[model samples]
Target: SLKIVFNFQAGFGILANMFLLVFYTFIILCYRPKPTDMISCQLTFIHIVLLLTGGNIWLWDIFGSLNIENDFNCKATFYISRVMRSLSICLTCLLSVFQAVTISPSSSFLAKFKYKLKKYMISVFLFIWSFNVSFTSHRIIYSGIFTNVSETKQMKVTKSCSLLSMNYIIRALILTVIISRDVFLVGLMLATSAYMVIILFRHQRQHKHLHNLSHLRASPEKRATQTILLLVVSFVVMYWVNIIISSTAVLLRMYDPVILSVQKFVMNVYPTITPLVQISSDNRITNMLKHIQSLCHHIFKKR
Candidate 1:
């Protein structure tokens, strides 16, 4: 029953995410996503995929049984969900790097590489997909159609299967790579955000800056920078909290289901929260609301 409710909630969440993605795409299409806007669009698209994958898994788990007839569907569902979740995490790291690069100062050598790298975005995205697919194929090896016997027995029966021992060193290497990537991107976000804040502060201190203050204050680029800063801060805080808990659990070799559940919840919640944050702050949505109000008033006058 709880699982069913979770699926329903996830479905609603995915719907909301899709609506936001479309709205943002429209903004990008009409104006077209600048190279910078492309980062947000890609993140939003990945986020939608993550939510849909999760929701489908839950829905199928509740409503679709794992029979031989449905075994392929089950495998496909799990595979796609795992791939999408991993891709979302990977793409988020890319998004941070992309944004940081976009805002890099012209004096910085890094800025010179931006034009060269601009053409590689699609290629990079394709690489991300291929990387995730290669790693997540392990799901196919481990999961299969299960046969359940009399009230208490269930088996992950496999056909002529030889168990391959897990290489702890290899697993550790993969984990280290993921963590290193996250840490690097987080550091970049910190540096870029700090630079932006310092620039704003210095501008505020200039006495001659007063006359142009209103214009500077209303600059879209500044607002966008501030928004990215907020995202970076929230991501760092939440991610570190999870990291601390997760590292402790892994080091201690704690296998308590409750602890595992909490860890999983922490992972899911971040993506769920992001769309809400974006919608709550979207000025374009507010402007659309005002436009709707004006149209209503105009209709009433015509009546």
Candidate 2:
């Protein structure tokens, strides 16, 4: 059941993310590229890579093949996946914060950032990629083929690649840094989410007296903020669930097969649900799908 669940998560997640990535790519190219769309496109690409690496879709099978016979495969898979996961968190946080800033009231301090945020997004992406790569480089040194020794303890990540133990001081320090990073990002997301809620509430109060029905339709900014808030909430929920499963495994010093699989499910949950939520919320995607459907229908009629 665990294996079945994991496979479902991985399969569905990759497909959903691919669907969003293509749509976002088209939007970026054929239309005016919004900052959120660009960030989401990049994030979709990152999730695809994550699904490939950590999603157990290809990495295990590919590395298990005879063509690859070294610890290099293990190091590369864990390191790359780790980097991508870290990047995903950063990008999600960026999206949430960007949306918050996008919707800020004109009189607020956050309003000052609204104009310049889009211009510097690419730079932010580059910096985050570099930072995560460097921060997770330690994974390379600690990941290798699992050697079964009855007397020795190890965290078996896969049939082949496992996490070798690190020095106490080094391990503690790295764990601390990683924890700190997650906490800070999660905190920022919460803060921005709160700010957005306040903004939305005030927006309603300010507009309450007006008889105009025009405000009934959500503006692009409002829609974007609501979508991002949903994503941030989803991300935070999955992150904590995955962290709990992982911490439990680490504390007991044994990665039970069930626990590990649950962790995978938890990790994949966010990526799988994200695109679906975005697709449901975005009218543009709905229109795009409708356009394609009508075009296909017209072609069939002609045939």
Candidate 3:
């Protein structure tokens, strides 16, 4: 069933996000992340909550065997799931923008506060949560379960819940704001990344005479930066693909269950791929794994 597929994807996404959240939290606890790293940590945790909540709704739908046509819980479940999801998207975009700002050049305005307000990171996260909470409360208030016509009467036999037209308009407005934020941050990220690349290229050339073969290649920061850039690119690509698919479905006034199932699957990739990106590029993670392997070998030898 379509519900099963959606549940599967949502479960996968939640599990992946949980892994990423734990990994990052370990990093943060073991060694305090740079102020910028805190943003990523927070974002990952937020995503875990989003995916878990969304997964619960789909799982409930798959198992409840309740008619959406007459079910209040069905409507509330979807409303909450979507609100959490949209909030996650918005928060991730904010994280990306924060990182881009942190890495910007000294001459840039964002750079002015980089070292000055490092203590405000917690407050910043609180603000992000507050924003999302206030923005989506109306979903809890205005949304409700509705009965659809039977298959012979008009639409399909399967029951489903949806927002009313007025609520949908509100959702569109909120989504537009989130989309605008994503676009602006994405543009800034691209510009900042390009600038860093150009600077690194020039530096690599300048240092060619002073360093040996390996040293002449990419610096650690350059490699790490590139990895983070790739992470951003992956997030952006996945987001836009989902947006495109969603937009098409909305415009055609055709909510195909198949496409929704596919969308859920696509959503899982971002969190799963994100951890691998960090692990592959981070010397700390590599060293941690190596340390664990050595410990295992030592214990085995003693046995």
Candidate 4:
């Protein structure tokens, strides 16, 4: 039953993320893409790749069997998954910061910074990838298949792909690196989101009369800002919950299959929900879907 559940979750996540990737590719090719849209497209692409790679690993774990066994598979899966997961978090943080800067008052320092950042957005993305790859390189070096022996009188051998043993110093270093990276990215996202809220609040207070006159009116930027804010909030909540569950499991040395399955499910919730949130919040995508539906209805009526 758990295996069936995992398979279903993995299948759904992969399909959903793939749809998001295709939709964004269409938007970029057919429409004038904004900086935020570009970032979102890239983020969606990463999510698709991550889901493909990580989902396979989870499936293997669920089945408890593999047709082919190799150390390379273990290393490749761990390396790609770690790098892509970090990249996903960093890209989301970039999205939040980008939206905050976009909504800043024109005369503020953030507005000037935004213009400069826009000029080097590609460079910034390159830097993020390079930094994450470099830091996550240890996964490739320290992860491989390990052989475990049963403690019974009749020794039984079990081969599993996981983190290989290392010296205490090296282990500590890697743990520190991961924890620090997560803290920095999460902190940056929270700070930028809080700042954006403050700026929006002030603007609302200052333009209270204008807002009253046009109560239902919201600019595109405002809508985008709200969407991104919600995405960030949701991501933060899922991230922390996953973190707590994972940390507890690790600290307690609880390696039960059910516990592991729950952890995997928690880890996947954010990516699974992200594309849905993006599609529902963006008016263009919703409008495009409505247009297509109407066109199909008209054609059928003529027939």
RMSD after CA superposition, every candidate: 5.5, 2.3, 4.2, 3.5
lDDT of 4: 0.78
Q: Write the per-residue lDDT of candidate 4 for residues 1-303, one digit (tens) a residue.
A: 766776677678778778778888887898888888889988888887776666354645633565544567667777897888899999999999999988888888889888887899999999999999898888787766555543221111113565655678987987898888889989999999998889877867778866583665767877788888888998899889878866775565424555566766766777778888888888888998899999999999999
lDDT of each residue in 1-303, candidate 1, tens digit only: 545644655666677678778877888779756565566676677766766654344644544454333556546655776787677656666655665566667887668868766888778878988888997787665444554433122222122111132467866776687677667767776776677677556546774445665555445555656666677677777778778866776565424445544554555565666667666666776688789999999999999
Model 3 per-residue lDDT tens digits across residues 85-171:
655555555555555555567887778777655767678678766776776666665544444533222222123544444456776
1 against 2, candidate with superior TM-score: 2
Residue pairs with colliding backbones in model 1 are 28-32
Who wins the lDDT comparison? Answer: 2
What is the C-alpha lDDT profile of model 2 across 1-303, one tens digit per residue? 665666777888899999999999899889998888989998899888888777474555565576684688888888988999999999999999998898887888999998788778778888998999999999999888777774155677665667888899999999899999999999999999999999998887787787475648777777878889999999998888888887898787754777867777777778888888889899999988999999999999999
All candidates' lDDT scores? 0.62, 0.84, 0.63, 0.78
Native-referenced Cα lDDT, model 2: 0.84
What pairs collide in candidate 4? none
Clashing pairs in 2: none
Question: In candidate 2, where is summed lDDT lowest over 10 consecutive residues?
Answer: 55-64
Return the top candidate by TM-score. 2
TM-score versus the correct structure, for each prediction: 0.72, 0.92, 0.78, 0.89
Model 4: residues >4 Å from true position, as ranges? 55-66, 149-159, 211-215
Clashes of 4: 0
Q: Is candidate 1 or candidate 2 better by lDDT?
A: 2
Which ranges of candidate 3 are over 4 A from the true structure?
1-16, 55-58, 61-76, 101-110, 149-159, 167-176, 212-220
